[model samples]
Target: MITNPSTSQLVRSVSTELRAKVLPELTDPALLVEVEMMLSMLDMAAVRADHEIAWMMQEADGIDTALSEAAVEGELPAPVRDALHALQLSRPADLTYPEVQRHYGLASEALARAADQAHAGDERLRSLAWSLLEGRVDHELATIGAYVAVGRSENQT
Candidate 1:
């Protein structure tokens, strides 16, 4: 019987196979470098596949919590208000990529507008927006993890 492998599991298996088998067979320097990059990409893909959905969900929720308060303050710009309103109206129908992506897109827009408001000296909005921005940056940094350039001649350690 065939069992299902999680995306990360499958990606790691392929990466391991490439490193153990294909790497040994690669004779050309250029091909070795290219294959090393491919292995790095596979690692990245595994990490992203495991965490991207949850990160997006957290970011979306953070935006909603922060911007919902700003919406109540009644001082947001027209575009910002509209974006927030759209977020409120457009709940994700499911956890599918397209559904989550649609929700995330609206949240991103709302966050951008709220960030503009914050920059314009809305103190409460500023703190809230900053937290959201930091959370976004954290997610991005986590996805990138370490950036040691594998197989790049200049980055050889």
Candidate 2:
């Protein structure tokens, strides 16, 4: 529902900058990539959360009238299709940070990525989602930032 083009663009730019700036601070190139991947994954998670919230809204209303009443009532609604497509895009892989680590042998990396992505989303959600869905990504980003900092610092000395 919060579809401000300028705001969305700013959020994306800030997120990219944060990741790029932070990556060099950590000497481990592998960790850097892992963090990037995790953030990307988390970004997906935020999108998923948003989609779920939207779906819930639709379910409550029996139709997303805001998207398109015709779409919701008709056999094939543009809004419904659009929402589904966004949901599909937002759905994260079914791997948690630990699962991702164990499966890929990048647990720490997974954690960092999750955290970073969450943090980045948090930073943007205020400007992104105008409702309850706004804060979902904050926790993830904070966690990622903490882990990455700790790991990088531990390795530095």
Candidate 3:
């Protein structure tokens, strides 16, 4: 059995070759900017290929935790009650991307539905959900890594 080069390696290899071989001979400003955009997309693709699944799984886990806590609270708000009912349904049997994506969607929806209730244990669950959302923002920031439009007027320096 042979292992394949990772998406990051493949994309970086192509980008590097293009930078070394192609960029040197290119004189068109428009084309140079376009190539830069393409390189940025390739970089993003590499990062997503490496980390998207793990991030999704982590978010799903956090959402499930919140839902589980919300489910047990007495006199639950309608959103929490509905989310708890929705969550009681079984998740997908397979753990493929599409299946996991579907599972994440359902769980995320459940958590969003219960985001506003601030009574009793509901407040704790909402707080947990807020923390999870903050973590999600952190993950996204890590993924995008302080992106700024490179060719923008403000970026001209």
Candidate 4:
């Protein structure tokens, strides 16, 4: 059986073609800047297409884990507690992007509260919340690094 090109592959091909063919022929500085921005966005999208869902799920799972741990040791704010209970009852693996995003929004609020509590002297909860936040930031930074590397390579070539 034959399969079509994956989304990332298609995006990479287009970005490569634009860089090698179209970019050189363009004379307008403004148009060149626009095209370059488009290329960078496409590159970022391609990277995300390859990993965003997994990252989302991973993030959700981490939030769930942190909430569960926090629940065992201390009291969470009402909104966070409710959101965590809802998350626990649902299957995260079955969630779509929008659903995950909604849950993530709730988790963010809960995390913020957790951070506040942590600063108020709850070291255990603070550690868990910060771990989740740090992991997320690291993931984002990796994606940004990939885009920056692509931009650097384009500049070099």
Candidate 5:
């Protein structure tokens, strides 16, 4: 049986080959700089390749969950409530990436508005809103941490 290279492996291999074989041969300084930038982007993509979809799903789920919780509280502004209702009506699993992202954006805006209202009047809702935001931030940091780790390892070598 044969196994296929995973996306991360394929990306890393291409980046390594470019750095070792192609980078040194480039004669134009501007082109060299551009190639270097491309390599950096490739490195980040390689780091994200294995986890990108999962991260996106997690983000969408978090947004959905936050919106649901806010909706139940009944203190959200009318526009925010309507937006959350619209988002809730669409199943995240049934949506494409762009659709999910758009829903998440709407949810995020609504969440922020709810959080602001909570901050002024409701302690429990405020805490819940902050928790959701913190979770989202943590998820983002985990992805960023992978890129930072790659940068550190490259610098150390």
Candidate 6:
């Protein structure tokens, strides 16, 4: 979500490949299918990430109440206690809506990469990608997966 240098680099690399090499090589109609699949995956990832962010934000808001209630009522389940502790440990900014929006931006870039890469000179992949990119893809579709790979560069501390 923070868009570390590594994530930025990966997106840049994929974008360069899509524009410089992938697009030009796409001629076969079969590639469209791959494109479509990629789009579906992208959309799914974006949607899921969006949902998760929303849920997390909502959960964050309720943390104080939950923790207070748990302290008064009794001990909480291990997971609930862990979640509460983690929530307390996280900075307010980290759980803010802006952070979620940044994550959504990353999701979009990831989807774009998948769509672009679906062009393997196959008509299906091209068509798939095109249709999905153009909004022809179905509502009930797969997700555009995120690369958590940027985590390595994150300063968790």
| Model 6 TM-score (2 dp) | 0.32
lDDT of 6 by residue, 11-31 (tens): 445545564666456565456
Give the poorly placed runs of model 1, Cα more than 4 Å off.
1-4, 119-124, 153-157
lDDT for each of the candidates?
0.83, 0.41, 0.71, 0.75, 0.69, 0.45
| Top candidate (lDDT) | 1
For model 3, what is the C-alpha lDDT against the true structure?
0.71
Give a tens-digit lDDT track for model 5, residues 25-63: 977766776777688778767767777656666765776
lDDT of 1 by residue, 33-112 (tens): 88888888888898989998888888888888777776686677787889988988888898888898889999999999
Q: TM-score of every model?
A: 0.84, 0.26, 0.75, 0.77, 0.64, 0.32
The TM-score that candidate 1 achieves is 0.84
The Cα RMSD in angstroms, rounded to one decimal, for candidate 4 relative to the true structure is: 3.5
Count backbone overlaps in model 6.
35
Backbone clash count, each prediction separately: 0, 6, 0, 0, 0, 35
Residue pairs in collision within model 1 = none
Q: Please give me the total number of clashing residue pairs in predicted model 5.
A: 0
Give candidate 2's total backbone clashes: 6
Candidate 3 residue-wise lDDT at 122: 61
User: Across residues 1-64, which tens digit of lDDT does each residue of candidate 3 receive?
Assistant: 2157987778778888887888777677677677767877877777877887778778877777
State the lDDT of candidate 2 residue by residue for 17-91, as single tens digits: 667787668667677667766655554454444344343333323222222333344433333344533432332
- Candidates 3 and 4 compared: the better one by lDDT is 4
Poorly placed runs, candidate 4 (over 4 Å): 1-4, 92-95, 116-124, 146-157
Question: For model 5, what is the C-alpha lDDT against the true structure?
Answer: 0.69
